[model samples]
Target chain A: MAPVSLVSLGKAFGSIEAVRDIDLEIADNEFVVLVGPSGCGKSTTLRMIAGLETISRGELRIGETVVNHLSPGERDIAMVFQNYALYPHMNVAQNIAFGLRHRNLSRAEIKAAVLDAARLLDIEALLDRRPKALSGGQRQRVAMGRAIVRRPKVFLFDEPLSNLDAKLRAQMRIEIKRLHQRVPTTTIFVTHDQVEAMTMADRVVVMNNGVIEQVGTPLDVYNKPATRFVAEFIGSPSMNFFDGTLEAQGEDLVFRIGNGRALPVPRARGSAYSKHFGKRLTLGLRPEALSVSDASDFTIEVETKVVEPLGVETIVYFDLAGHPASVRAAPNRAPRAGETVPLSFDMTFMHLIDPEDGSVIPY
Target chain B: MVSRGGILANVATYAAAVLIAAFFLVPLTWLVSLALRTPQEIFFGASRFIPENPTLDNFGQVLRDRGFLNYLWNALKLSGLGALGSVIVAAPAAYAFSRFDFRGRGVMMMAILAVQMVSGLVILIPLYRYMGWLGLLETHVGVIAIYIAIGLPITVWLLKTAFDGVPIVLEEAAAIDGYGHFETFLRITLPLASPGMASALILNMILNWSQFLVPFIMLSRDAQWPISVAIYNYAGSTTASTTHLLAAACLITILPAILAFLLLQRAIVSALTAGAIKG
Candidate 1:
């Protein structure tokens, strides 16, 4: 295994820049996921690292050697593609042994390697079957098996589970995570799905508009997002943002959401917001941080619009001061649509941001 | 429980299909009937489905006297060489066009399509002059070379379409698996493109086997002639009997092409269907 680092990487096609200057370092035996919306250059970054794409500018290093000009084969990497690109003519065993055949390994060694990979992926019985004969999940396993047999320095996955059905995607997600544990190669996975990134990454790199927004642990990105884009992009159902202004009242900093409705700011967050006083700001609050309470520090009346019951928890969509927002509540007492619910805001969990630049207030 | 109109429509559809099949088979049936009759009987006997007295003399005469087997072998050799040459030259160019983003790609593709539009007859004199300039006139190599060059545009276009249908992800995956671009194309792309190649080869073989003008203009030696040119010799010869000309030479010339079609029918059907469905 080898640590890979990309410094100030950029890729441009003609006049359009697909990926801008980006720098990231992936540690040895670490699984880093690049997550973003479509056309966000996550896949382009991964391809540049794999040497499948040329880097327009910047340096890429695998361990100590710069690999920007090296061919993909010389880079010693394996990739699982989104479509599971198994060789149609070759059966599962031949597909898995294709890489080993290029080396000077003996036939017996190739067979043993294929067998070991098949056994690891639980696809030994499918060795003789062609790609067309296998089911989607089976083809996925064979694709992974092909990569596993190579045992390259790095493993790249380009949305490998996107083609599978929902149930199979969930199942394969766990399988991939377990496989990473066993192999422990430096892996870079690219996906548009935040759930996959959060579940599988050792460190998640959230990207937007061809730039890295933040790189940290899953919980770290969720809890302490460096920017507003990371805060909204990392969580399920997304974080809700409300336009507000920062003001000082009696030696305390507060965010005024609307006329006469103000929420107290935490001291740590207050220090971050002091420089932006009287300027337009945005407040980000996760659904779980808001709840219904009779005696609360700050109260807001909302008209419930939708209720989603998920056995353990319920999602309540309501209008808060004319802005639509959702709140996750205990399933024991779920609110119904059209009911006016009194919700309490947890000021400590509130996130403040600059509305002009959409950067977090560094709290 | 069926309605009368539905039954009538079904009968009409079946009758139309049978009529079309009969219309297509009638020419071959006539040829077979003429082959069975003797020269005198063909002229004297009444028109019938079967001959009064069938004979194998035409087949014997063509094989023994006319050297039909040699002509058939020459045709096979020329068509085989021409098709192989075209495939070899076209596959790499097609792969490049399909996979790369070079400048003038659109113009190059349009040029290839334009070449296909120009008939071989229109360029006959210029091609002959070029071959003579290269010191290749009156040679089988000259004829096969011309056929390969004429057939390359279509063959390359067909293979390019096939290569385009294969997703780039497959090549990327192969590259990451320690295979270079050329190795990936050989091991993965070419194998996946077998159906398209087979279809193009069959089409090119048919075209080369039935070619008349190029071989006629290039080859002055009768021994170097393909079956098509050889059959034309018999047709134009005034000394040869009409029975031998119609039965022996024509049937002998077409037999190999018919056999080739029969042998590769499955691949041809699948290839045609693949092109249609993909489009």
Candidate 2:
């Protein structure tokens, strides 16, 4: 078990840069998930850490060794690729024991290690089958078994569950978390799915456009995002942004919108936006924060455009003076599509984004 | 489930196929008929298409007096070693061509193609001079060398296509599993490309066995002649007719080709998709 550190990492393919200036420290026995959309350089960063890709200009240290010049075998990292690149000619036992073939171990030791991995992954019955004969989920388990038998210093997974169906993906996500708990190896998993990051990561690193937007626990990133990109990207039915200008009237700050509505800013962090009075900024509000409150400081009247009743909560989508917005309300109190109702924001949980640069003006 | 039009079309297809099969089968039947008859029957047309008397005496004359056994051994050694040596030498070069990234890769492949595209007769005089300087004019090794050179370009291209079809991830997985590049290639990629390797070996053997020009240009000794050249010796003489010995030797030569086709036709079919459709 050892920590890995990457400092000022950058990668380029000729003139086009893929990843730029990334620095991250993964502690020993910690599970970190890199979450982003496609082309965000998340997989490239994981490959660089796994020693599969050459480091363009950076220093990468694993445990105590600077591993920029090391091969993947020298780095002691096991990677489970997205497609499960199993040797088609080898059976399950051979696939699991392949990593130990060159190890200075006896036959009995290799057999025992393979048996242990099969037991842990519950693939004992499948030890003799080929990959093409196994189901998708079984193949994934075999892939994990191959990685875990080696018990490398670091485990890297590149979207291992993306090939599974929905129910199986959820089940394997929990199994992967349990495996991490049991083995406690420093693991780095990369995926474009945010739900997997939220459910499985000890810490989540959100990336966009080849840059790290924020790195924190799932709840912290969901609650207090540090940028407009993070604020919009971290939630399902993403946050709504409305163009508004700030006005400091008397001793309070208010947001003036085009629909002749002025919202009172929460006074708990009014000083952060005090200097930006009369300046154009963007106001962000999550759908869950907007409930059906009759009397609230932040209120807007909207005619419902679409009502989605998902049993636990009903989401109502409507246009806010030509900008699309949504509200989460009790399912029993869900209004019809043609009805008009007033939605309220709790005001303290509102996100303020600077329009000049796509960063949040932290309160 | 059969429609009227579909049945008619299938009947037509079967008719066309049977006609094509008969077109190829007639010459074989005639050859067998020719080998079973005596030279007197062949010249006078006294025997029918079915011989009145079939005899092993023609095979005996071919084996005992016509040097059939020596020619068969010489041809087998030449063709077998030529094909085997070509595959062994071309595999690593093809692997390097497919997997590495360096300057002039495209140019090197194109250069190979250019050399293969050139007329073999254009280089004949120079090749003869080169062989003479090496004192390799009349040996089996010299003929084998020429056959391997003729087989190299096509064999390398075939094996390169197979190597390219294998995913690099398997090799990377092997590397992470503690095997080096040499071991990974031997244990992983080579086994996956077995069908292609088998196909290339068979194709090279066929190519080497059928070649006549290089043997004519290289070997001047009658004792070192391959079966193809020996067959010409019996048939191309001015005093000879289409003797029973030539027909017996020709029939004997077809056995090896038939055996090879029976054994390797599946390997060739599987080679078209090996390492390509699997993980």
Candidate 3:
């Protein structure tokens, strides 16, 4: 395994820039996931690293060798495509052994390697079956086996689990993590699904448009999203935003919303916004941070528009001034629609964003 | 659970199909009957649909003819080589058309397709002159070259569509598997496209087998004549006694093409319609 570094890497198709200049260093044996919405250049970045796509400008190095000018075969990388591009004509064993053809391995060595990979993937019984005969999950396993059998310097996955059902995707996610733990190859996985990125990556690189928004451990990105895009994109049900101006009330700061209701910011966190008092800001709140309990620092009464009770927890969606917001509550305590429920805000978990540029305040 | 209306529609469809089949099959049946007849029956009972007494003597006599065997060999050689050569020459161009987005690709494809619209007879004289200047006249190579040229446009189109049906991602997967561009095409794309190549081969074989004018003009010696032209020659010199022999020769010439179609019918149809619906 070897580290990969992309120094000011970019990709352009004619005049349209698909991936802007982005720098990243991926350590050897590290599992890095590039997560973003569709067309966010995550896949483009992965493809560039795999040498499937050419770099428009800047350098890409795998270990110490620059691979910007190399073809995919010359780059010593294996990619598992979204569709699990197994050769339909070849059975599983042949498909898995396909890469070894250029490795100068003897027939016995290749056979043994194929068997070992099949056993590792728990696909020994499927060795003689063609890809068409395999189920979705089995096909995905074979795709992984094809990549892992080569023991290439890096493994590239382009939304490989996107083709599977939800349960299968979850199972494969863990299987991939376990596989990486066992082999510890440097891997770059790209996905539009944030949950996959959060659960799988050693470090999550959240991208937007064509640039990196944040690159950190999943908790770092989730707990302290660096930008408004990261705060919204990384969470299910999304974070809510309210346009407001910060006002000083004694020593504590208060966030005054459009409707003129004020949420008193906790005094311990007030110093971070004291300098920005009277400036327009957007307050970001995670759904889980709002509850019916009075344990929070600030509280507001909202007329619930929808309540979704998902057994474990309930999500109460409401309009905060003019913006949509939701609060997660205990399933037994969810307020019904149209009810004026007291929603408490956990100010310690809140983010104050710069409304002009969508950047979160350092605090 | 077919409804009454559906049953009626099915009956009507079958009736129309049978009528169309009869439109083409009656002459073929008559030819078979003529081929089975004795010389006496062929001479006196030509109007009858069924022979008074059928005999295998005509088939036996035609099969024994050295000239007929030579014509059969010539036809097989020319058609086989033409089909194989056409696919070999067309496959790379087809792959380019299928996979690459070079400038003017669509326009070039249209230009290649336009070649098929022109009748072979329109170009046969010029082709014959060109072959003569190249010292290829009256040779198997001359006739086969014309066949390959005439067959190329459709072969290229058939193979292009076949190549298209083989997913692009498979090639990418092969590339990541350490296979170069040519190796990927050979090992991944070509195998996936075998049905199309098979279809193209059979199609060109059928087209070149029945070819008359090109070989009829390019080949001067009767010894070098393919079955189609040889059969035509035989029909021109037919006497009353040899009419049954001529019918047997016609059946011999037509059987190979029909058998080839019957054998590879599924491959041909699948190649034609494979990519109509994609996942």
True interface contacts reproduced, per candidate: 0.88, 0.85, 0.88
- The TM-score measured for candidate 3 stands at 0.96
Predicted candidate 2 versus true structure: per-residue lDDT over B250-270, tens digit per residue: 888766866787788887656
**Residue clash pairs of candidate 3:** none
For candidate 2, the TM-score is 0.91
Q: What lDDT score is found at residue A5 in candidate 1? A: 89
Q: Give model 1 RMSD, 1 decimal.
A: 2.9
Clashes of 3: 0
Point out the higher-scoring one by lDDT: 1 or 3. 3
Off by over 4 Å in 3: A294-298, B1-19, B43-47, B276-279
Ranking by DockQ: 3, 1, 2
Every model: Cα RMSD to truth: 2.9, 3.3, 2.1
Q: Summarize candidate 3's per-residue lDDT along A1-363 as a digit string, tens digits.
A: 999999999899999999987999999999999999999999999999888888998999999999999999888899999999999999999999999999999999999999999999999999999999999999999999999998999999999999899999999999999999998999999999999999999999999999999999999999999999999999888998989999987766788999998887878777677788899999998998788765655577789999899999988889988999988888987888899878787777879999788899887
- Arrange candidates, best TM-score first: 3, 1, 2
Scored by lDDT, model 2 comes in at: 0.87
Question: What DockQ does candidate 1 score?
Answer: 0.74
Task: Write one digit per residue (lDDT tens) for candidate 1, span A172-193.
Answer: 9999999998888999999999
